[model samples]
Target: MRNNGAVHGAFRSAAMRFFSPRALAAPYVVWMAAFVVAPIVFVVIYAFTAGDGAFTVGNFAEMGRFVGVFARSFWLALISTAVCLALGYPAAYILARESGRVQRAAVVLIMLPMWMNFLLRTYAWMSILERNGLLNRLLGALGIAPLDIIYTPAAVVIGMVYNFLPFMVLPIYSVIAKIDRSLIEAAADLGAAPRAVFTRVIAPLSLPGVLSGVTMVFVPAVSTFVISKLLGGGKEILLGDLIEMQFRGAAYNPRLGSAISLVMMVIVIVFMYFMNRFGEGEEGVAIL
Candidate 1:
Protein backbone atom coordinates (compact mmCIF):
# COMPACT_ATOMS: atom_id res chain seq x y z
CA MET A 1 0.00 0.00 0.00
CA ARG A 2 2.89 2.43 0.75
CA ASN A 3 4.63 1.64 -2.57
CA ASN A 4 1.32 2.16 -4.51
CA GLY A 5 0.80 5.53 -2.83
CA ALA A 6 4.34 6.64 -3.71
CA VAL A 7 3.81 5.73 -7.41
CA HIS A 8 0.50 7.64 -7.51
CA GLY A 9 2.13 10.76 -5.97
CA ALA A 10 4.89 10.68 -8.61
CA PHE A 11 2.37 10.39 -11.44
CA ARG A 12 0.35 13.35 -10.10
CA SER A 13 3.52 15.48 -9.82
CA ALA A 14 4.43 14.75 -13.44
CA ALA A 15 0.90 15.65 -14.63
CA MET A 16 0.91 18.89 -12.62
CA ARG A 17 4.26 19.90 -14.13
CA PHE A 18 2.88 19.48 -17.66
CA PHE A 19 -0.49 21.21 -16.96
CA SER A 20 0.34 24.05 -14.52
CA PRO A 21 -0.56 27.69 -15.22
CA ARG A 22 3.14 28.62 -15.29
CA ALA A 23 3.79 26.12 -18.07
CA LEU A 24 0.99 27.67 -20.15
CA ALA A 25 2.30 31.16 -19.49
CA ALA A 26 5.97 30.33 -20.18
CA PRO A 27 5.90 31.31 -23.88
CA TYR A 28 4.24 34.69 -23.25
CA VAL A 29 6.60 35.37 -20.33
CA VAL A 30 9.69 34.68 -22.46
CA TRP A 31 8.35 36.77 -25.34
CA MET A 32 7.55 39.71 -23.06
CA ALA A 33 10.99 39.58 -21.39
CA ALA A 34 12.85 39.51 -24.66
CA PHE A 35 10.85 42.16 -26.50
CA VAL A 36 9.06 44.43 -24.03
CA VAL A 37 11.22 44.27 -20.89
CA ALA A 38 14.55 44.32 -22.73
CA PRO A 39 13.65 47.35 -24.84
CA ILE A 40 12.42 49.31 -21.79
CA VAL A 41 15.70 48.50 -19.95
CA PHE A 42 17.76 49.74 -22.90
CA VAL A 43 15.68 52.91 -23.19
CA VAL A 44 16.23 53.65 -19.51
CA ILE A 45 19.98 53.15 -19.87
CA TYR A 46 20.18 55.41 -22.90
CA ALA A 47 17.98 58.10 -21.33
CA PHE A 48 19.97 58.61 -18.14
CA THR A 49 23.64 58.22 -19.12
CA ALA A 50 26.03 60.18 -21.35
CA GLY A 51 28.43 59.13 -24.15
CA ASP A 52 31.09 58.14 -21.59
CA GLY A 53 28.52 55.80 -19.93
CA ALA A 54 28.72 57.93 -16.74
CA PHE A 55 25.45 58.47 -14.92
CA THR A 56 23.89 61.89 -15.57
CA VAL A 57 20.53 63.65 -15.26
CA GLY A 58 21.24 66.05 -18.13
CA ASN A 59 19.12 64.13 -20.61
CA PHE A 60 15.92 64.96 -18.72
CA ALA A 61 17.08 68.55 -18.27
CA GLU A 62 17.63 68.78 -22.02
CA MET A 63 13.90 68.10 -22.64
CA GLY A 64 13.13 71.44 -20.97
CA ARG A 65 14.24 73.10 -24.19
CA PHE A 66 11.21 71.78 -26.10
CA VAL A 67 8.47 72.91 -23.71
CA GLY A 68 6.28 74.23 -26.53
CA VAL A 69 6.30 70.86 -28.33
CA PHE A 70 5.24 69.09 -25.14
CA ALA A 71 2.42 71.56 -24.49
CA ARG A 72 1.17 71.39 -28.06
CA SER A 73 1.20 67.60 -27.98
CA PHE A 74 -0.91 67.49 -24.81
CA TRP A 75 -3.36 70.12 -26.00
CA LEU A 76 -4.00 68.44 -29.34
CA ALA A 77 -4.33 65.02 -27.76
CA LEU A 78 -6.83 66.34 -25.22
CA ILE A 79 -8.97 67.96 -27.87
CA SER A 80 -8.87 64.88 -30.07
CA THR A 81 -9.86 62.68 -27.16
CA ALA A 82 -12.80 64.94 -26.33
CA VAL A 83 -13.99 64.90 -29.92
CA CYS A 84 -13.77 61.10 -30.08
CA LEU A 85 -15.74 60.73 -26.84
CA ALA A 86 -18.49 63.05 -28.03
CA LEU A 87 -18.82 61.38 -31.42
CA GLY A 88 -18.25 57.81 -30.30
CA TYR A 89 -20.62 57.73 -27.32
CA PRO A 90 -23.75 58.50 -29.32
CA ALA A 91 -22.73 56.17 -32.16
CA ALA A 92 -21.94 53.39 -29.72
CA TYR A 93 -25.21 53.88 -27.85
CA ILE A 94 -27.18 53.64 -31.07
CA LEU A 95 -25.30 50.55 -32.21
CA ALA A 96 -25.61 48.81 -28.87
CA ARG A 97 -29.38 49.28 -28.86
CA GLU A 98 -29.62 47.75 -32.31
CA SER A 99 -30.12 44.10 -33.28
CA GLY A 100 -27.11 41.79 -33.12
CA ARG A 101 -26.86 41.61 -36.91
CA VAL A 102 -26.79 45.40 -37.21
CA GLN A 103 -24.22 45.66 -34.41
CA ARG A 104 -21.86 43.22 -36.12
CA ALA A 105 -22.27 44.95 -39.48
CA ALA A 106 -21.58 48.36 -38.03
CA VAL A 107 -18.48 47.19 -36.15
CA VAL A 108 -17.14 45.44 -39.24
CA LEU A 109 -17.68 48.58 -41.30
CA ILE A 110 -15.76 50.66 -38.77
CA MET A 111 -12.90 48.15 -38.56
CA LEU A 112 -12.53 47.56 -42.31
CA PRO A 113 -10.61 50.75 -43.00
CA MET A 114 -8.14 49.87 -40.23
CA TRP A 115 -6.94 46.84 -42.18
CA MET A 116 -4.75 49.14 -44.32
CA ASN A 117 -1.39 50.53 -43.23
CA PHE A 118 -1.51 53.70 -41.11
CA LEU A 119 0.85 55.53 -43.46
CA LEU A 120 -1.35 54.71 -46.43
CA ARG A 121 -4.45 55.96 -44.60
CA THR A 122 -2.75 59.22 -43.62
CA TYR A 123 -1.54 59.70 -47.16
CA ALA A 124 -5.03 59.14 -48.46
CA TRP A 125 -6.22 61.96 -46.21
CA MET A 126 -3.53 64.18 -47.71
CA SER A 127 -4.94 63.61 -51.18
CA ILE A 128 -8.45 64.47 -50.01
CA LEU A 129 -7.48 67.47 -47.87
CA GLU A 130 -4.87 69.08 -50.13
CA ARG A 131 -5.34 72.61 -51.55
CA ASN A 132 -6.40 71.48 -55.05
CA GLY A 133 -7.51 68.06 -53.89
CA LEU A 134 -10.85 66.29 -54.13
CA LEU A 135 -12.45 68.07 -51.15
CA ASN A 136 -11.57 71.56 -52.35
CA ARG A 137 -12.69 70.79 -55.90
CA LEU A 138 -16.01 69.50 -54.61
CA LEU A 139 -16.47 72.65 -52.56
CA GLY A 140 -15.61 74.77 -55.60
CA ALA A 141 -18.21 72.96 -57.66
CA LEU A 142 -20.74 73.79 -54.94
CA GLY A 143 -19.87 77.55 -55.32
CA ILE A 144 -17.97 77.54 -52.01
CA ALA A 145 -14.47 78.82 -51.53
CA PRO A 146 -11.61 76.38 -51.09
CA LEU A 147 -10.39 76.32 -47.50
CA ASP A 148 -6.70 75.95 -46.69
CA ILE A 149 -7.19 73.27 -44.00
CA ILE A 150 -4.34 70.94 -44.92
CA TYR A 151 -0.97 71.39 -43.17
CA THR A 152 -2.67 73.07 -40.23
CA PRO A 153 -3.28 72.12 -36.60
CA ALA A 154 -6.92 71.51 -37.54
CA ALA A 155 -5.65 68.98 -40.06
CA VAL A 156 -3.73 67.21 -37.36
CA VAL A 157 -6.82 67.04 -35.15
CA ILE A 158 -8.91 65.74 -38.03
CA GLY A 159 -6.36 63.02 -38.71
CA MET A 160 -6.32 62.01 -35.06
CA VAL A 161 -10.13 62.00 -34.74
CA TYR A 162 -10.59 59.97 -37.92
CA ASN A 163 -7.98 57.41 -36.96
CA PHE A 164 -8.73 56.92 -33.24
CA LEU A 165 -12.53 57.24 -33.20
CA PRO A 166 -13.00 53.49 -33.47
CA PHE A 167 -10.96 52.86 -30.35
CA MET A 168 -13.44 54.90 -28.33
CA VAL A 169 -16.54 53.39 -29.97
CA LEU A 170 -15.58 49.75 -29.56
CA PRO A 171 -14.93 49.96 -25.80
CA ILE A 172 -18.00 52.06 -24.99
CA TYR A 173 -20.19 49.86 -27.20
CA SER A 174 -18.94 46.74 -25.50
CA VAL A 175 -19.80 48.21 -22.12
CA ILE A 176 -23.18 49.59 -23.14
CA ALA A 177 -24.24 46.42 -24.92
CA LYS A 178 -23.68 44.36 -21.79
CA ILE A 179 -25.59 46.72 -19.46
CA ASP A 180 -28.45 44.77 -17.85
CA ARG A 181 -31.76 45.72 -19.43
CA SER A 182 -33.37 45.04 -16.05
CA LEU A 183 -31.42 47.92 -14.55
CA ILE A 184 -32.68 50.36 -17.17
CA GLU A 185 -36.23 49.00 -16.72
CA ALA A 186 -35.93 49.30 -12.96
CA ALA A 187 -34.94 52.94 -13.32
CA ALA A 188 -38.03 53.53 -15.46
CA ASP A 189 -40.23 51.80 -12.88
CA LEU A 190 -38.87 54.15 -10.24
CA GLY A 191 -40.24 57.12 -12.26
CA ALA A 192 -36.86 58.06 -13.67
CA ALA A 193 -36.99 60.12 -16.87
CA PRO A 194 -34.88 59.09 -19.85
CA ARG A 195 -32.39 61.88 -19.24
CA ALA A 196 -32.16 61.09 -15.54
CA VAL A 197 -31.75 57.37 -16.16
CA PHE A 198 -28.99 57.95 -18.69
CA THR A 199 -27.19 60.49 -16.52
CA ARG A 200 -27.43 58.59 -13.24
CA VAL A 201 -27.32 54.99 -14.36
CA ILE A 202 -26.04 54.44 -17.93
CA ALA A 203 -23.40 57.14 -17.87
CA PRO A 204 -22.01 56.21 -14.46
CA LEU A 205 -21.97 52.53 -15.28
CA SER A 206 -20.09 53.13 -18.54
CA LEU A 207 -17.44 55.29 -16.89
CA PRO A 208 -14.86 52.52 -16.93
CA GLY A 209 -15.18 52.11 -20.68
CA VAL A 210 -15.03 55.89 -21.08
CA LEU A 211 -11.80 56.02 -19.11
CA SER A 212 -10.35 53.16 -21.13
CA GLY A 213 -11.37 54.87 -24.38
CA VAL A 214 -9.78 58.13 -23.24
CA THR A 215 -6.50 56.39 -22.43
CA MET A 216 -6.50 54.59 -25.76
CA VAL A 217 -7.17 57.79 -27.71
CA PHE A 218 -5.01 60.20 -25.70
CA VAL A 219 -1.83 58.15 -25.35
CA PRO A 220 -1.33 57.54 -29.08
CA ALA A 221 -2.57 61.03 -30.02
CA VAL A 222 -0.06 62.64 -27.68
CA SER A 223 2.83 60.55 -29.03
CA THR A 224 2.02 60.66 -32.75
CA PHE A 225 4.49 61.99 -35.35
CA VAL A 226 3.31 60.55 -38.65
CA ILE A 227 0.00 62.47 -38.69
CA SER A 228 1.71 65.74 -37.71
CA LYS A 229 4.41 65.15 -40.25
CA LEU A 230 2.21 64.51 -43.32
CA LEU A 231 -0.68 66.77 -42.27
CA GLY A 232 1.30 69.60 -40.59
CA GLY A 233 3.55 69.82 -43.68
CA GLY A 234 6.67 69.21 -41.57
CA LYS A 235 6.24 72.59 -39.82
CA GLU A 236 4.15 71.82 -36.74
CA ILE A 237 6.28 69.74 -34.38
CA LEU A 238 4.62 67.81 -31.52
CA LEU A 239 6.44 65.96 -28.71
CA GLY A 240 6.77 62.77 -30.73
CA ASP A 241 8.11 64.71 -33.71
CA LEU A 242 10.71 66.35 -31.49
CA ILE A 243 11.76 62.99 -30.07
CA GLU A 244 12.02 61.51 -33.55
CA MET A 245 14.02 64.51 -34.70
CA GLN A 246 16.43 64.00 -31.83
CA PHE A 247 17.12 60.42 -32.87
CA ARG A 248 16.70 60.50 -36.66
CA GLY A 249 16.85 64.05 -38.01
CA ALA A 250 19.58 66.75 -38.06
CA ALA A 251 19.51 66.71 -34.23
CA TYR A 252 20.60 63.00 -34.12
CA ASN A 253 20.87 62.44 -30.36
CA PRO A 254 19.56 59.10 -29.17
CA ARG A 255 20.01 60.14 -25.53
CA LEU A 256 17.74 63.15 -25.95
CA GLY A 257 15.22 61.01 -27.82
CA SER A 258 15.16 58.44 -25.04
CA ALA A 259 14.78 61.15 -22.40
CA ILE A 260 11.86 62.71 -24.25
CA SER A 261 10.31 59.24 -24.57
CA LEU A 262 10.65 58.68 -20.82
CA VAL A 263 9.06 62.05 -20.08
CA MET A 264 6.21 61.30 -22.47
CA MET A 265 5.68 57.93 -20.78
CA VAL A 266 5.39 59.67 -17.40
CA ILE A 267 2.90 62.18 -18.77
CA VAL A 268 0.71 59.41 -20.23
CA ILE A 269 0.86 57.51 -16.93
CA VAL A 270 -0.27 60.57 -15.00
CA PHE A 271 -3.15 61.15 -17.40
CA MET A 272 -4.31 57.55 -17.04
CA TYR A 273 -3.91 57.76 -13.24
CA PHE A 274 -6.32 60.69 -13.06
CA MET A 275 -8.74 58.88 -15.35
CA ASN A 276 -8.65 55.81 -13.10
CA ARG A 277 -9.16 57.95 -9.99
CA PHE A 278 -12.27 59.46 -11.52
CA GLY A 279 -13.69 56.00 -12.23
CA GLU A 280 -12.78 54.35 -8.91
CA GLY A 281 -15.98 55.42 -7.11
CA GLU A 282 -18.07 53.28 -9.41
CA GLU A 283 -19.16 50.17 -7.47
CA GLY A 284 -21.33 48.71 -10.24
CA VAL A 285 -19.34 48.41 -13.46
CA ALA A 286 -19.47 45.04 -15.23
CA ILE A 287 -16.63 44.06 -17.59
CA LEU A 288 -18.90 42.18 -19.99
Candidate 2:
Protein backbone atom coordinates (compact mmCIF):
# COMPACT_ATOMS: atom_id res chain seq x y z
CA MET A 1 0.00 0.00 0.00
CA ARG A 2 2.83 2.45 0.89
CA ASN A 3 4.64 1.60 -2.35
CA ASN A 4 1.44 2.27 -4.31
CA GLY A 5 1.00 5.61 -2.53
CA ALA A 6 4.59 6.68 -3.36
CA VAL A 7 4.06 5.82 -7.02
CA HIS A 8 0.85 7.80 -7.10
CA GLY A 9 2.63 10.84 -5.59
CA ALA A 10 5.39 10.66 -8.21
CA PHE A 11 2.88 10.44 -11.00
CA ARG A 12 0.96 13.42 -9.71
CA SER A 13 4.17 15.44 -9.45
CA ALA A 14 5.13 14.56 -12.99
CA ALA A 15 1.70 15.50 -14.23
CA MET A 16 1.97 18.98 -12.58
CA ARG A 17 4.20 20.37 -15.34
CA PHE A 18 1.28 21.94 -17.17
CA PHE A 19 0.32 24.02 -14.15
CA SER A 20 3.89 25.01 -13.28
CA PRO A 21 4.77 27.21 -16.24
CA ARG A 22 1.29 28.56 -16.73
CA ALA A 23 0.57 29.14 -13.07
CA LEU A 24 3.91 30.88 -12.52
CA ALA A 25 3.59 33.02 -15.67
CA ALA A 26 -0.04 34.04 -15.33
CA PRO A 27 0.51 36.42 -12.40
CA TYR A 28 3.52 38.03 -14.07
CA VAL A 29 1.54 38.60 -17.26
CA VAL A 30 -1.30 40.12 -15.25
CA TRP A 31 1.15 42.30 -13.33
CA MET A 32 2.74 43.53 -16.56
CA ALA A 33 -0.66 44.29 -18.02
CA ALA A 34 -1.63 46.28 -14.95
CA PHE A 35 1.63 48.20 -14.62
CA VAL A 36 3.81 48.36 -17.72
CA VAL A 37 1.28 48.01 -20.51
CA ALA A 38 -1.32 50.11 -18.77
CA PRO A 39 1.01 53.07 -18.18
CA ILE A 40 2.32 52.98 -21.75
CA VAL A 41 -1.22 52.82 -23.11
CA PHE A 42 -2.16 55.78 -20.99
CA VAL A 43 0.82 57.72 -22.28
CA VAL A 44 -0.04 56.98 -25.90
CA ILE A 45 -3.64 58.03 -25.40
CA TYR A 46 -2.55 61.22 -23.69
CA ALA A 47 -0.07 62.02 -26.43
CA PHE A 48 -2.77 61.87 -29.06
CA THR A 49 -5.49 63.75 -27.19
CA ALA A 50 -5.71 67.51 -26.70
CA GLY A 51 -6.74 69.38 -23.55
CA ASP A 52 -9.92 70.64 -25.25
CA GLY A 53 -11.24 67.12 -25.99
CA ALA A 54 -9.87 67.03 -29.55
CA PHE A 55 -7.27 64.77 -31.21
CA THR A 56 -4.41 66.99 -32.33
CA VAL A 57 -0.70 66.87 -33.30
CA GLY A 58 0.26 70.06 -31.51
CA ASN A 59 2.02 68.31 -28.61
CA PHE A 60 4.32 66.40 -30.94
CA ALA A 61 4.69 69.37 -33.29
CA GLU A 62 6.08 71.44 -30.42
CA MET A 63 8.90 68.96 -29.91
CA GLY A 64 11.45 71.12 -31.74
CA ARG A 65 12.40 73.11 -28.63
CA PHE A 66 13.20 69.88 -26.83
CA VAL A 67 15.50 68.59 -29.58
CA GLY A 68 18.56 70.44 -28.29
CA VAL A 69 17.97 69.06 -24.80
CA PHE A 70 17.81 65.52 -26.18
CA ALA A 71 21.01 66.08 -28.14
CA ARG A 72 22.80 67.30 -25.02
CA SER A 73 21.58 64.27 -23.13
CA PHE A 74 22.91 61.92 -25.84
CA TRP A 75 26.37 63.48 -25.92
CA LEU A 76 26.65 63.60 -22.14
CA ALA A 77 25.70 59.93 -21.93
CA LEU A 78 28.25 59.10 -24.65
CA ILE A 79 31.00 60.83 -22.69
CA SER A 80 30.07 59.03 -19.47
CA THR A 81 29.99 55.66 -21.26
CA ALA A 82 33.44 56.34 -22.73
CA VAL A 83 34.79 57.16 -19.29
CA CYS A 84 33.31 53.97 -17.79
CA LEU A 85 34.78 51.85 -20.60
CA ALA A 86 38.21 53.48 -20.19
CA LEU A 87 38.29 52.59 -16.50
CA GLY A 88 36.35 49.32 -16.46
CA TYR A 89 38.21 47.47 -19.26
CA PRO A 90 41.55 47.22 -17.41
CA ALA A 91 39.82 46.49 -14.10
CA ALA A 92 37.77 43.71 -15.68
CA TYR A 93 40.87 42.25 -17.34
CA ILE A 94 42.73 42.15 -14.04
CA LEU A 95 39.78 40.52 -12.31
CA ALA A 96 39.36 37.91 -15.03
CA ARG A 97 43.06 36.94 -15.08
CA GLU A 98 43.32 36.54 -11.32
CA SER A 99 43.04 33.27 -9.34
CA GLY A 100 39.68 31.92 -8.25
CA ARG A 101 39.75 33.30 -4.69
CA VAL A 102 41.02 36.66 -5.92
CA GLN A 103 38.35 36.78 -8.60
CA ARG A 104 35.59 36.06 -6.09
CA ALA A 105 36.89 38.68 -3.67
CA ALA A 106 37.24 41.29 -6.42
CA VAL A 107 33.73 40.64 -7.70
CA VAL A 108 32.32 41.01 -4.21
CA LEU A 109 34.18 44.27 -3.73
CA ILE A 110 32.96 45.61 -7.06
CA MET A 111 29.35 44.72 -6.32
CA LEU A 112 29.38 45.72 -2.64
CA PRO A 113 28.44 49.37 -3.24
CA MET A 114 25.30 48.37 -5.14
CA TRP A 115 23.78 47.29 -1.85
CA MET A 116 24.00 50.88 -0.69
CA ASN A 117 21.45 53.52 -1.69
CA PHE A 118 22.32 55.29 -4.95
CA LEU A 119 21.30 58.65 -3.54
CA LEU A 120 23.69 58.15 -0.64
CA ARG A 121 26.55 57.48 -3.06
CA THR A 122 25.72 60.59 -5.07
CA TYR A 123 25.61 62.67 -1.89
CA ALA A 124 28.96 61.23 -0.86
CA TRP A 125 30.40 62.68 -4.06
CA MET A 126 28.79 65.95 -3.09
CA SER A 127 30.76 65.87 0.16
CA ILE A 128 34.02 65.20 -1.61
CA LEU A 129 33.65 67.68 -4.45
CA GLU A 130 31.85 70.60 -2.88
CA ARG A 131 33.73 73.81 -2.13
CA ASN A 132 35.49 73.65 1.27
CA GLY A 133 34.86 69.93 1.13
CA LEU A 134 37.42 67.20 1.88
CA LEU A 135 39.13 67.57 -1.50
CA ASN A 136 39.71 71.29 -1.14
CA ARG A 137 40.95 70.84 2.40
CA LEU A 138 43.52 68.32 1.19
CA LEU A 139 44.59 70.75 -1.51
CA GLY A 140 44.85 73.50 1.13
CA ALA A 141 47.30 71.38 3.10
CA LEU A 142 49.42 71.09 -0.06
CA GLY A 143 49.42 74.92 -0.45
CA ILE A 144 47.51 74.63 -3.74
CA ALA A 145 44.51 76.74 -4.55
CA PRO A 146 41.11 75.15 -4.09
CA LEU A 147 39.53 73.92 -7.29
CA ASP A 148 35.87 74.20 -8.19
CA ILE A 149 34.77 70.67 -8.95
CA ILE A 150 31.10 70.61 -8.00
CA TYR A 151 27.96 72.13 -9.62
CA THR A 152 29.32 71.93 -13.16
CA PRO A 153 28.91 69.68 -16.20
CA ALA A 154 32.16 67.95 -15.17
CA ALA A 155 30.65 67.12 -11.80
CA VAL A 156 27.61 65.62 -13.48
CA VAL A 157 29.85 63.38 -15.63
CA ILE A 158 31.89 62.35 -12.61
CA GLY A 159 28.76 61.40 -10.71
CA MET A 160 27.44 59.45 -13.68
CA VAL A 161 30.72 57.53 -14.18
CA TYR A 162 30.89 56.71 -10.49
CA ASN A 163 27.33 55.43 -10.49
CA PHE A 164 27.60 53.38 -13.69
CA LEU A 165 31.16 52.03 -13.60
CA PRO A 166 30.17 48.74 -11.98
CA PHE A 167 27.54 48.18 -14.66
CA MET A 168 30.35 48.31 -17.20
CA VAL A 169 32.79 46.16 -15.19
CA LEU A 170 30.62 43.13 -14.37
CA PRO A 171 29.48 42.36 -17.94
CA ILE A 172 32.98 42.82 -19.36
CA TYR A 173 34.44 40.60 -16.65
CA SER A 174 31.84 37.90 -17.32
CA VAL A 175 32.81 37.81 -20.99
CA ILE A 176 36.56 38.06 -20.27
CA ALA A 177 36.40 35.18 -17.77
CA LYS A 178 34.82 32.93 -20.40
CA ILE A 179 37.54 33.68 -22.93
CA ASP A 180 39.57 30.56 -23.82
CA ARG A 181 43.24 30.95 -22.97
CA SER A 182 44.15 28.69 -25.90
CA LEU A 183 43.12 31.44 -28.29
CA ILE A 184 45.71 33.80 -26.83
CA GLU A 185 48.32 31.05 -26.98
CA ALA A 186 47.41 30.33 -30.60
CA ALA A 187 47.85 33.99 -31.48
CA ALA A 188 51.29 33.97 -29.89
CA ASP A 189 52.27 30.77 -31.75
CA LEU A 190 51.38 32.54 -34.99
CA GLY A 191 54.00 35.28 -34.28
CA ALA A 192 51.44 37.77 -33.02
CA ALA A 193 52.76 40.15 -30.35
CA PRO A 194 50.91 40.75 -27.06
CA ARG A 195 49.31 43.89 -28.50
CA ALA A 196 48.26 42.04 -31.64
CA VAL A 197 46.87 39.14 -29.63
CA PHE A 198 44.86 41.53 -27.47
CA THR A 199 43.49 43.45 -30.41
CA ARG A 200 42.71 40.44 -32.58
CA VAL A 201 41.73 37.92 -29.91
CA ILE A 202 40.71 39.46 -26.58
CA ALA A 203 39.00 42.53 -27.99
CA PRO A 204 36.97 40.66 -30.56
CA LEU A 205 35.91 38.00 -28.06
CA SER A 206 34.78 40.60 -25.50
CA LEU A 207 32.61 42.61 -27.90
CA PRO A 208 29.29 41.32 -26.55
CA GLY A 209 30.21 42.36 -23.04
CA VAL A 210 31.47 45.74 -24.26
CA LEU A 211 28.24 46.36 -26.12
CA SER A 212 26.21 45.42 -23.05
CA GLY A 213 28.22 47.70 -20.77
CA VAL A 214 27.94 50.64 -23.18
CA THR A 215 24.16 50.31 -23.38
CA MET A 216 23.81 49.91 -19.61
CA VAL A 217 25.74 53.08 -18.94
CA PHE A 218 24.58 55.19 -21.88
CA VAL A 219 20.81 54.68 -21.60
CA PRO A 220 20.47 55.56 -17.92
CA ALA A 221 23.04 58.33 -18.03
CA VAL A 222 21.11 60.09 -20.78
CA SER A 223 17.71 59.87 -19.03
CA THR A 224 18.79 60.48 -15.42
CA PHE A 225 17.39 63.66 -13.88
CA VAL A 226 18.53 63.29 -10.28
CA ILE A 227 22.25 63.35 -11.01
CA SER A 228 21.90 66.47 -13.10
CA LYS A 229 19.72 68.13 -10.51
CA LEU A 230 22.13 67.45 -7.67
CA LEU A 231 25.39 67.97 -9.58
CA GLY A 232 24.60 70.35 -12.43
CA GLY A 233 22.47 72.59 -10.16
CA GLY A 234 20.03 73.92 -12.79
CA LYS A 235 22.83 75.11 -15.07
CA GLU A 236 22.57 72.10 -17.34
CA ILE A 237 19.28 70.75 -18.66
CA LEU A 238 19.00 67.28 -20.15
CA LEU A 239 16.01 65.62 -21.82
CA GLY A 240 15.02 63.97 -18.56
CA ASP A 241 14.59 67.32 -16.89
CA LEU A 242 12.58 68.62 -19.79
CA ILE A 243 10.21 65.65 -19.74
CA GLU A 244 9.98 65.85 -15.98
CA MET A 245 9.04 69.52 -16.22
CA GLN A 246 6.17 68.77 -18.54
CA PHE A 247 4.66 66.48 -15.94
CA ARG A 248 5.66 67.98 -12.58
CA GLY A 249 6.60 71.61 -13.01
CA ALA A 250 4.98 74.75 -14.38
CA ALA A 251 4.25 73.18 -17.75
CA TYR A 252 2.09 70.39 -16.28
CA ASN A 253 1.23 68.82 -19.62
CA PRO A 254 1.03 65.04 -19.54
CA ARG A 255 0.56 64.85 -23.32
CA LEU A 256 3.84 66.64 -23.96
CA GLY A 257 5.55 64.49 -21.37
CA SER A 258 4.30 61.36 -23.12
CA ALA A 259 5.56 62.57 -26.46
CA ILE A 260 9.01 63.31 -25.01
CA SER A 261 9.16 59.96 -23.29
CA LEU A 262 8.22 58.19 -26.53
CA VAL A 263 10.88 60.07 -28.46
CA MET A 264 13.52 59.20 -25.86
CA MET A 265 12.52 55.57 -26.02
CA VAL A 266 12.89 55.60 -29.81
CA ILE A 267 16.35 57.15 -29.52
CA VAL A 268 17.44 54.48 -27.04
CA ILE A 269 16.13 51.71 -29.28
CA VAL A 270 18.01 53.08 -32.29
CA PHE A 271 21.23 53.46 -30.31
CA MET A 272 20.99 49.86 -29.02
CA TYR A 273 20.40 48.57 -32.55
CA PHE A 274 23.69 50.10 -33.70
CA MET A 275 25.55 48.73 -30.67
CA ASN A 276 24.16 45.26 -31.35
CA ARG A 277 25.22 45.52 -35.00
CA PHE A 278 28.75 46.36 -33.90
CA GLY A 279 28.72 43.37 -31.53
CA GLU A 280 27.62 41.09 -34.38
CA GLY A 281 30.44 42.36 -36.57
CA GLU A 282 32.99 41.53 -33.92
CA GLU A 283 31.42 38.08 -33.44
CA GLY A 284 31.71 37.46 -37.17
CA VAL A 285 35.38 38.44 -37.17
CA ALA A 286 36.04 36.15 -34.22
CA ILE A 287 34.34 33.28 -36.00
CA LEU A 288 36.56 33.73 -39.06
Best by lDDT: 1
lDDT of 2 by residue, 1-288 (tens): 999999999989878974787777988899999999999888888887899858978889989887778888888899999999999999999899999999999999998988899999889888998998999999999999998989888899999999999999998998899899999899999999999999999988998888888889898998998888888886778888888889997989889998888878888999888878777755522211
Worst 10 residues of 2 by lDDT: 279-288
Reference-based TM-score, model 2: 0.90
lDDT of each: 0.90, 0.88
**Every model's Cα RMSD, please?**
2.6, 4.3
TM-score of each: 0.92, 0.90
Off by over 4 Å in 2: 1-18, 281-288
Q: Write the per-residue lDDT of candidate 1 for residues 1-288, one digit (tens) a residue.
A: 999999999999999999898899999999999999998888899999999999999998977878988999999999999999999999999999999999999999988878989999999999999999999999999999999999999999999999999988988998889899999999989999999999989998888788788888999999999999999887979988898888786889999899889888987888778877778886543322
Against the true structure, candidate 1 reaches a TM-score of 0.92
